[model samples]
Target: MNGDWLLRGRDGRLTVYLPSGEAVLCRAERGPGGPWEDAPRTVGGTQKLHPGAAVGQGADRYAHLAAWRPTVPGESGLVHTTHFRPLLAPLDWVPIGHPDKKGDRTGPPAVAVDGPGRGYVFVRNAGGGVSLRNQKVKGGWGGWLDLGGQEIEERLAPVAAESGRVELYACAPGAILHWHQEGDGKKPVRAAEVEAAVRPGTLRALATSAEHTTVFFTDDSGDVCAWRPGEKPVPLLAAAGPGPVSAVRCVIEGHDCTVLAQRSASGRVAFAAYPTEQESAGAWWTESGPQLPSDALVAVALDEHEELVAASLSPSTGTLLLTRRKDEPGLALEAWREI
Candidate 1:
């Protein structure tokens, strides 16, 4: 499973998106530390590349994949599964067009879904700006709308924070490019900048609650930073290398906390946490996580209860090894049960 993306679906399962456009779904047991189960086959009937995961509510609660359209050669497309189903067989795959006029676009399209099942996909076109499309509730797919900007330098994925308002973000060179839409029937506000950038492909975001969405990425100096809306980016602990960054909002020691994890340049995994009620973003990060053998860290996702499910490519097997922590109260990294 040369997975490219990790995301948690509304069904409380962690989904791993592979380079071949297939997906593997894992679900936890009723309690903490038992065996986890995976679907019998590859879900999401996608035969393309750069798979993205988008989970919406109600009827649209299924996992959506936005990837390079293998059928169309150079364009991108959108496909979705039935809500909360075990097998993520495609409900529909729509060719929504690409951002660039030519060549494969950077990475897979990023998707965000609203409470009512409205979906938005973002792609960095060959023109260097971002291209977007919308799927309205009870309506068909809309046309491509170019939100022009050449500063986006990499094939970083996009994350959407949906509350009453919906906000989207992408990693740009030395900044975080953002977009948002508020109110019914109103236009979206686009491209707000947060001056924090890391190596391409390392940015990640988590919508902790309805009121707060935090973005994290390794900076140029190898330090991880956390950014919230209307606040400056807060620098946290340093990493040995710039790999991937992931965060999960969970209860630890009976208090809400965000567990931030990253892979060092040397291929070791590390994690740290801070209280959700803490006001300062510059809080220290404790190095209490378990180090695992990995070539590249793929994706990290949390279930409905905030139990973490992380996948990394095994250096020896070249397959995805899945791990989850025991359900206990401790800041230190718990022993991971391999699936």
Candidate 2:
């Protein structure tokens, strides 16, 4: 898998993506926190880490794709079974107008869960409106509700999820989408003014348990904004190299959380992360280099503890940098904790 990347689930199932395409069932079981009995779950189909696993409900293994992209998956169309196989009807191409004009976008419609099945997906619509879509999972199909709308923009990644559905943020638009599981009915109601700021910034989504949510973004000048929603957005490492922050990936291996962000300078891509207390990301970015299927894309997933996992990509290039923890520093790769 030599393309942009996304960690789909805690099952450690990696989705190697290509510009306008992707390859599913890329990697296999590794590290920890996954159901030991179901250590090796395959991609495609409604494969759950455990038979008792439910979507954002009960005490069971949490299952989700590391990320989503709207690309055609190598002209195969993301609706193909090799990418994602649902029993639902084949998705008819809506031709949301010119997909190219929209800037940097990722995979198909996907949702990250913090509390329950409060459907949250990325919508690539007309007039370059980069937005978030929410669907309530109550044993029925809930019409996709629009969340955040980017005036004129491109791609995005799965922001964050916790005890309560917080903000779903993305990049190129430098905005955030907000959703809440409302009134005894787990319906993800859309709210206006979800955009956190107007300053250009890097947008990264990390998953975790019912504890925290992480949103990473970068500014036009190259400064990064790490947001936790209700909390103020903080700056991670400064843009030491040339280009803006390319991508950011958050992964949970054992007990620690790690974020891998990519920076493209003089056409060179470098990936790194900012760790946190809890692995609070369901998806992230992967297009750091020119190696991803859809060029720039998003990633997300849940570990066995139902904790969140993720990664991110940059402006283009399409290469991915994964983040797990670094045992040397108590993290997975080289990261320690968010602090």
Q: Which candidate's TM-score is highest?
A: 1
lDDT of each: 0.57, 0.38
- Candidate 2 structure quality by residue, lDDT tens digits, 156-253: 44433544453444443445654444443344454422345534324445544455556555555555555555666555555534323433333445
lDDT of 1 by residue, 1-339 (tens): 211255555555554444323443333332333334542344444343344444333223455545455446544444444335423444544566656544554645566555566666666776777777777656887677777777675444444454544565677667887666666423356746777756667666667666767777678887777777677877777754567666667777777788766666555666667876263643444432345565555456665567665666543444555566665557544544355
- Candidate 1 runs further than 4 Å off: 1-14, 21-40, 46-61, 71-83, 100-103, 162-164, 184-187, 277-294, 315-318, 332-334
User: What is the lDDT, from 0 to 100, of the residue 3 in candidate 1?
Assistant: 18
Cα deviation at 179, candidate 2, in Å, is 3.6
The lDDT, on a scale of 0 to 1, for candidate 2 is 0.38
